[model samples]
Target: MFAGDSDLSLTSIDLFCGAGGLTLGLENAGFLSVMGLDTNRDAMATYRKAFPDAEAVEGSIAGYDFGQWRGVDLVAGGPPCQPFSNGGKRLAAKDNRDMIPEFARAVNTIMPRAFIMENVAGLLAPRNREYMAEILSLFSDRYTILPPRLINAADYGVPQKRMRIVLIGLLKGSIDFPAPTHLPGRYVTSGSVLRRGETQGYSNPSKIVYARRPDLRPSPYAGQLFNGGGRAINLDLPAPTILASAGGNKTHFIDELHAVIPYHKHLWDGGKPRSGELEGGRRITILESAMLQTFPTEMEFAGSRSSQYTQIGNAVPPRLAEVIGASVARALN
Candidate 1:
């Protein structure tokens, strides 16, 4: 893992901040976040529960003062991943995807020194590319553009191999790809990391390796954080990304390994062992999923078992937030 950028003292405002992944990454980087805005009630509840000190506003950002956000050093979020994913029905600027543009309006109003936008790699799809282009194009008229970089949580030490596009907007300079803190784990087959060292790609699009969209799910990631190559971060990496499915819900069905184990149901009921997994072809439990997302060890839920799961899944990985915060701090210093 990367040496923590501990001295950066920037602050941030998170938008469309479902579960707070961007918020968490920025916090990890050393930025002090003042607020997070999202429409989902449970998602906000979970964010507030974990980050009691920060203001987790539950609502659309459309009616707020984009101008009042000026003092912050950064504005960040992943928005909704589903609207642009190939696995789901693709929706670009038309399918409620216009929120991306709305997000831009927020950034324009607040005007941080730097802003970051992240979404599923499918956002890079030919048609959706224009929407991304439009957002950046409008911003570029006044700010330095970082273009857009695609990265995976796995490459950065998180066990799951989720890949997304990150757009960095600077007030006066450019943004390069963040340095690699970790590489692919040995256990996660080469197919998952990059097409067998092909690095770039050949004429046949599928033959292309590194450029291919990253697929989530690391091979057999049920155990603790162990990057055989010796990375320093935990299983969820610096901080885990919150899932849209997270927060106050864990109606899971476990695999026979967890189901037929003949062990007490209480143990796996809400522990860290089950995340993104299906037991007996059913969803995993609540508690385990939260731990996988790396919620603070002290965090607790006041509602039912599923309520607890919902909160965890909806929270921003505190670790990732720190990373973003650190970068902002660097610029401020």
Candidate 2:
């Protein structure tokens, strides 16, 4: 499948490829993932199990060799948003959060045609923006920076509402992030997914339920992310960024309706069932979380429950990754 358009059929190396969400997207975008590197051995296990052919190196990202790790299409799985996120503490650029420079240092050494860095919205906070600008400026000689965009996962087909910042860089020509396909309203509809024991998927338009017929329509998600007159959007475009702790972190959510899905009766244990107290719940299962990130069904997480959560949470949603990879692949021409 990846045999055609060799220049555009780019080879990829994913750094910090936790459970391969970004790699999954690049694979979908028709790139050959030659290798992946990550710190967590467990995430490496998950990544290797699903992609046995791809080489997955497990260890700290600091020492990864840029020369040995060269690829025509470069990508970063994540740079660890911990220092930037306000959830724990806002370290911004100083709190051991300055690894992106090292990441860029390696990128400069390898010098791929294009690359992308995904991060928390907090990276744009005044404290960190200067450093981010510095990194952008450093890359200016080689890459035409695509204006950083704050994208919501719901803007695409994702069932969740999560915001993320993406910086896309190209060697010469400017890269334009794709325009949002679905706008508010304009045929975007919200509906409820039935539990395993429930009757079926339905669009109670009065209740905003989309009905699934046994003969025709197939049910997607069984649980609903809406209540109190809010709803999930079925977008025609690619989904917003699938967050690392997307379902777990409620503070990142915009709509009250979306923030509640993780705790609610999702397709967990095959969709048997959440309480009202689940409002600020712990999190949803790793499987449900990965699904929201657009990983393929054939791939399974190979780790403990929490490891699975950590792996899925720390990933760049594959759907968004596809856009990034395809953009680079096109640029290679």
lDDT of candidate 2 vs native? 0.59
Structural similarity to truth (TM-score) of each candidate: 0.67, 0.71
Position 4, candidate 1: lDDT: 30
Cα shift from native, residue 27, model 2 (Å): 1.2
In the range 1-333, model 2's lDDT, one tens digit per residue, is 222436545777787788888888888877888888887888898889877888888887786667865545665556778888857487656668557776687678777777788877787777877777776876637677787788765565444445788888777666568666445553222222112222221111122222222111122222333332122323332223334443333211222244423423243334333223323212233454566566665667876655665677677777677776776667665
All candidates' lDDT scores? 0.54, 0.59
Candidate 1 residues 155-205, lDDT tens each? Answer: 555444456777777887655557656665432222232222232211111
Best by TM-score: 2
Clashes of each: 53, 15
After aligning candidate 1 to the native by TM-score, how far in Å is the CA of 265 from where it should be? 29
